[model samples]
Target: MVGGAILRKLEKRQAGGEDLTLVTRTSTELDLTDQTAVRSFMQSERPDQVILAAAKVGGIHANNSYPA
Candidate 1:
């Protein structure tokens, strides 16, 4: 939901005639935890901005294993 909200804000900015380049990659296409792949992507695309909104949430059982 946060990611979608951010995308909507960016789209609004673009609609206002700002020169922006938007790029997106699915989980199948990119492994966000992979360092080498990320570095290569940055070198090639050379983007002005980047947003990382990756989230991994486990169920209640998993949450109970952690401390307060």
Candidate 2:
């Protein structure tokens, strides 16, 4: 939830030609547990900074289980 809000703010900023490459993926699309897929994604994208927004703080235990 927090990450998504931040992403929206960044998107608005990028509209002013910040040239930021904001890469984001949901848990379903990019499983953090899979090392091979993560390596492939990082090599292909080569992000300068990685935002590790893997936690949902205000959530129930059942809804906040990270695959790690």
Pairs that clash in candidate 2: none
RMSD of 2: 4.2
Best by lDDT: 2
lDDT of 1 by residue, 1-25 (tens): 6787888898899889988778888
Q: How far does residue 8 in candidate 1 sit from its true spot (Å)?
A: 1.4
Please, what is the TM-score per model? 0.74, 0.73
lDDT of 2 at 52: 81
Best by TM-score: 1
lDDT, candidates in the order shown: 0.82, 0.84
Quality of model 2 by C-alpha lDDT: 0.84
Query: On residues 1-68, what C-alpha lDDT tens digit does candidate 2 reach at each position?
Result: 77888888899999988989889888899999999999999999999999786874645664556533
User: Residue 66's C-alpha lDDT in candidate 2?
Assistant: 50
User: How big is the positional error of residue 15 in model 1, measured in Å on the Cα after superposition?
Assistant: 1.9
